[model samples]
Target: MIHSHVPVSDLREHIGRTVSVRGWVHTLRLQRAMQFVVVRDGTGLVQVTNRRDGGPLEALIEALTPESAVRITGRVVDAAQVRLGGLELVPETVEVLNPAATPLPIDDRTGPEQRLDWRYLDVRRRPAARLLFAVQTTLEQGMREYAYAQGATEMHTPKLMGTASESGAEVFELGYFGRSAYLAQSPQFFKQMAVAAGIEKVFEIGPVFRAEPSFTSRHATEFTGVDVELAWIDGVEDVMAFEERMLAHAIAKVADLHGEAVAEHFGVRITVPTTPFPRITMAEAQEILRSAGWDPSGTKEDLDPEGERSVSAHMREATGHEFVFITHYPVGLRPFYHMRAADDPGLTLSFDLLWNGLEVTTGAQREHRYDVLLAQAAEKGLRPEPMQDYLNAFRHGCPPHGGLGMGLARVLMVLLGLGSIREATFLFRGPNRLTP
Candidate 1:
C-alpha cells in the first residue's frame, strides 16, 4: 500500500516511517556515493537523501532538474548532516512524472524588471510570491466575512456599461457589437442602484478598468476595486468609520494567520489600525505642509504625489500613524455625485484615505437631488440624458447614501511597502502588459 501522506517539514516524529511524497525538485546536490535533493510540495520544502547504488534512485537523481514533477517512496530519517531544517528522507524508490526543460531563463536571482517580464518563473521563488498570494487570500476572506457580519450583501456588477460611472477622461472605450461601450471605472452607479432597489447595505469586490497612461508605482490599467455603500448615512464620517473597521478586521485576520511569515518575508509589522483613523481637512493639510516649508501650491485642490508624501511624513512625525483621512474636498475638484455641504457649498463632504503617502480609497456622500445632480453633470460638460436611469432613482426615493472605491492592490502595496502595484497583483494587466 502506498501511504500518500508525508509532512513537508522534516519533524522527528515521522522518522523511520515509510511514506509516499509528490513534489517538484527544487534543488539537487550530488556526491560520490550519495545525493541530496530539496523538494517543494506547495506547503513547504523537504530534503531527501538517496544512496547512489547503481539503481533507479541514482538514475532519478541524474535525471532530476529544477521544477520537475516527481513522486517517491521514502522512509523519514533524522538527518543531522542535512542543512535544511534538520531532517531528511531516504527514498527507497522514485518515479519521474515529468521532466523540465534545461536552461531556465528566470529564477530567484532574476531582477525585478526581468522577473515581471517572466512572472511565472518569478512565482517559483517560493517565499516572496507565495507570501503575497497568501496575504491577498487572507485579506479577501476577512473582508467578506466582516462585511457579511455587518449586514452587507456582496454584489457582482457588470464590467461593460453604456456610460461611465465617474468623470469620462479615464474611461476605456471599445465597440460592443457595433455600438460604443466603455469599461466601468467604478461600481458607483450600480451600487447606488442596489440602494434604490432596497438592498440597504452592499459591497462589491471586482475589477475596474481605466485607460489613463500612467507610469506611477501605484497606478494600474485594470485593478480590483473593493467597494462599499450604504443608505441612511448622516455624512462622510459614518462611511469612514465603516471603512476603518473593515480595514482593521482584515489586517488583524492576516496577522493572526500569517504574521510570522509576513515578518520574515516582508518585514511588515502588521497593526490592525485602531478605529477613528486620524482626520484632517484639505485646508488643514495644506497649512501643515506650509508650516513645514513644503508649500503645495494652493491652486490645486487635491494633493499631488509629492504633496501626499510631505503630508504623510508630517502625519507620521506628529501622530505616529501611517493612515490619514483628508476630508472636505473642494466642490470643483469632486465628482458631480458628491454632496455639497449645507453650511458651505464650496466644500463637498468627501474624504481620501491615504496610507503611507498613497491614496488607497476615495469616498464621499453622494447628491440625492436629481436636479442638482443633473446641473452638476451639465456643468462638468457631460450630457445628463445618458444618466437618466441613475437620476430617476434619486427622483422617486433615495436616502442619504455614500460609499468608496478602494484599490485592493494599492492597499496591499502600501501595507507591505512594495514598490509597485504590479508586484502585489497576480498577472498584472497594465497598459503595456496583457499576456501571461
Candidate 2:
C-alpha cells in the first residue's frame, strides 16, 4: 500500500492531468537549465522533467541516483519531439522514498555468473528477463487448459520417496530420522498409478531432482518438470500426438499474447509448430548418422549430443520443421517400463522429442501388463523387491497407458532462442551452483 501512486503503464489514459508516480530511478540527465529523470516502475517507464526555477529542486535532482526509489507528482504531457512513447511528465514535486546503493555491482555488460550473483538487480535491468517470465506464464496456463480439456486431472506429486523413484543410478539420497530416503527423480510411478486407479488422464507440474555431476549447459540438478500420462492409448503415437498438440497450443498462445515484445527483446519470432512433427525411428536415425560418417565415442545405445544435433538438422532440412520425434529406440536405450513394439521385440515404443538440437522430452507407451513389466524389469537387471509398491498398482487391474516428461526450462530456452537453459531458469541449480 506504500506505493499508492498510479501505474506508469496507464499514464497515457491520464494525459494532461496531474498524478503521482512511484518507481526507481532508471536514468538521470542533468543540464544547466533543466533536468530529466527516467523512472521505471516495472510496468513501464516515465521521463520526469525537473526544471531549474531557483529552488531546492536542483539540489534534489543532483542528489538523485539510478535505482533510487522515488515518488513524483507530475502532469503528463505529450511532446512530439520526445522518443519514449512521445510522452513525458513535468514534475511539480519529487520525494525520495528509498535510496539504492551507488555503483551497482552488475550492469548490462556483466557476465552471466556475476549477474546471477545479483539476480534481482539483473532482472530489473533487463527487459528480456521480464518477457521471458511473461511468456512462461502463458505457456504454463495454456498447457493447464489443454490438459483439463482432455479430461486430465492435475496433480501435485510428492518429492520425497522411500526409495529411488526413477533412474536408480542418478538419484539424490538424503538421511531420514533413522532411515535413508531419496528425492523423486520424476513423478513417473505416481502418474502411471493414477492411470491404474482409472483417472484416465493426469498431468503434474513440479520440481524433479537428479544427482548427476554433469556440467553441461542443458543439465540442471533441479528443474521444473511437465509430466503427463494417459490410459487406454492405442499406441505410443497417441502420446506423441498429444504432446505435439499441447506444445503447438502453448506456443500459439505465447505468440498471441507476447509475440511482439518477445521479438523486440530477444530478436526471435515465435512459431507455433505444425502438427505431426516429423518422426524417424531410432534405427533410421542411426542409419542416417552412419551414412553421414558419424562415429560415436564407444558403442553407445543412445544418440550422443552431436548425433542428436545432426539428426535434428537433417529433420529441418528434409521437413522444414524444428521438432523431430525419434521413435522406437532399442530396449537398452530406454527405461524398463517402456513397452517393446509387438512386431519387433528388440525396439521399444519410446521416443525422444528433439527441439532444434536438444532433446527436450522422452515419452513412451508404458507396459501396463504386470507380468510383462516385471519381466522387462528383470531383463534390465532390476530387482522388483524395492519397486513392489509401483508394481502393485499394475497387479490390481490397470489400463493400457503411456506418458512423457518435458523440461520446462529446455522448451523455454529453445523457444526464446536463448543459448542455455540457465537463461530460462529464474534460480538455476546445477552441480556447482546452489546459491543465488
Pairs in steric clash, model 1: none
Q: How high is each candidate's TM-score?
A: 0.96, 0.96
Candidate 1 segments exceeding 4 Å error: 10-12
Tens-digit lDDT track of model 1 for 91-191 = 88778899878777787677877777878767865577878888999999998888999999999988998976556678988999988999998889999
lDDT of 1 at 346: 90
lDDT of 2 by residue, 229-288 (tens): 999989999999999999999999999999999999999998889998999998899888
| Global Cα lDDT for candidate 2 | 0.90
lDDT of 2 at 279: 95
Report how far off residue 232 is in candidate 1 (Å): 0.7
Please report how far candidate 2 places residue 426 from its true position, in Å: 0.5
Task: State the number of backbone clashes in model 2.
Answer: 0
Stretch of 10 with least lDDT, candidate 2: 1-10
